[model samples]
Target chain A: MKNLKIDETKYTPEMTFDPETLVIAIKGKSYPENTEEFYKPAFEWLEKNLSDLGKKGLTVNLELIYFNSSSSKALMNFFDMLEESVDNGDNITVNWMYEEDNESILEYGEEFLEDIETLPFNLVPLKSRE
Target chain B: MTDCIFELKNDLNKNGIFFCFSGPISQDLIVEIGDTLKNKMRLEDASKSSMRLVFSIIIEQAQNIIYYSEEKVRPWSAGVNAGSISVGIITVAKKDNSYIITSGNMIKTEHVDKLKEKIEKIKGMGKDELKQYYKSQRKKDPDEDSKGAGLGLIDIARKVSKPLEYNFSSIDETVSFFTVTTVVAEGL
Candidate 1:
């Protein structure tokens, strides 16, 4: 297993996933012209990394400043993958973090938590900053 | 008669719309309006949570127009963009026990149907299920860049009392326009 890191940019977020910790983190804005183009590789990496997940545990930290509708579809696919991984005996925990004053983002975290009941999910609060 | 128009004004004692601006938007514009609206909300005693919803809707809708409006024109500033963006919200507290903050803007026609479908699906979802769906989408296509992924409307619909309503008006041979509105109750 290996680790992958996609550094942040003005329009993109910081993504860091470690196979050893089974932790995946995506934080920042997402309005990429080709979302699938960017995420396809990440998904593929996860697929290969989790092939023998019978004894592995995974945790993902999701935080965002903002994302376009296009990015939203990609996010759904990411969650579905996590659900599949959990089903495949990979203990999965998703920690959705949102700013304290950003009620919409908080509710967003809550909404995602509702979709997947098969895995462990946490809706955590982060301080709002300008 | 001229009296009819005058009478219309007399009968409709207005609040003098505090602020209204329309057409292609930008992040700077959003931030500026956010400041103004936040001040207004504070003055009106609107709950922090409610204000956040309204603010988020503005960002979502404005960004939608900036990035997806089909009637796009070459931006005024090179490299920067200006789509069919508009930002206008009016809040009227009626005697009928309803506080309405109605806002709408033009959108691309091609992006409408799937948006409607996604809103409907969200309206039918229970709270817990809505969260799960949101998460699933997050995990599945974390880089959701499709013009139609439409998580923005889904998130907004989850706040409204009913499904989202939209309209597409034929603007010309090449493009159609769109508008979306969301209504939140006073004490929901």
Candidate 2:
């Protein structure tokens, strides 16, 4: 399957889904007016890609800058989807990346890991280039 | 009860309120208000950086009202919309020689539980811990959307000199008019 790329805006974030390696990256500030409307297409694409099994390993990277509470529930649903997919035999690795010194992002990673039993999550620290 | 709309000059002169607006809000409204607040705060010699922080919080909280407020009035346009959001008087008043900023808003009951949960958690955290948690939340997939968890309160807490304070009145079981008052310390 072909890769899907969604661009980010001042109020939203970018979404990337690839069939080549089964990896996805979402990065940006997401306080979208309509959370479901914005995420519907991406979720569909992910479902399709996961079903095809075109890639052996699945990795999801979240390097988000910001999001609203509505987006928080959506993130949980996304992880739930991943958890189920892994239970279905997909090898999923989720990496939550945070900039060094930004501890809020780290705790969020820990919180997301609380419910998942199927995926391997790595909370990686980002070294400041400054 | 306020007639709600007083002439800007008279209102300012009478109340000493630096800025105030009450009614419909959206992204457009937020941008417009942000521009004005940013300017006024800077002119008052409030640090530009901290002022930006306050402006962002105002936008988020106001947007919440625009989207979630149940209070409705007959609309000549834009259909039935959310309740009003007002940015009341913000003074650079001194407390023991330090400056503090105070802003307020009214929210709904359903929204109140959620806000309280989040706010309480934020209050429980240490500054460094809150910073890390916020960073970690940001690092998560943005596609995993939340109704209020994202940048709204986190940004407010990060920018504020201390934790936020809130009060509310139960209009009924289904609704509440919640108010959030946040302060910023300007070292004397």
Per-model chain A TM: 0.90, 0.90
Share of real interface contacts recovered by each model?
A: 0.48, 0.21
Error of 1 at B26 (Å): 4.4
Question: Each model's TM-score?
Answer: 0.61, 0.62
Give per-residue CA lDDT, model 2, range A21-123, as digits (tens).
5678898767676677888898888777775552388778898755555676678778888878777777878888887755556666787776566677888
**What's the residue-level lDDT of A89 in candidate 1?**
72
Model 1 misplacement above 4 A: A1-3, A6-13, A19-22, A27-56, A63-72, A97-110, A123-130, B1-16, B26-45, B76-146, B161-176, B185-188
In model 2, the runs with Cα more than 4 Å from the true position are A53-55, B1-21, B28-60, B70-164, B167-178, B184-188
- Tens digits of per-residue lDDT, candidate 1, B1-188, equal 89996765554446333455555455567566656776876787777666665555655665565556554445556565444333333232222322334445445556567656666677778866876675556555333545445466666665665456666666655556666666555445
Interface RMSD of each: 4.3, 5.6
Q: Which digits, one per residue and each the tens of the lDDT, describe model 1 over residues A60-113? A: 889986665566677767777778777777777888888887766776566566
Per-chain TM-score, chain A, candidate 1: 0.90
What RMSD does each model have against the real structure?
6.7, 6.8
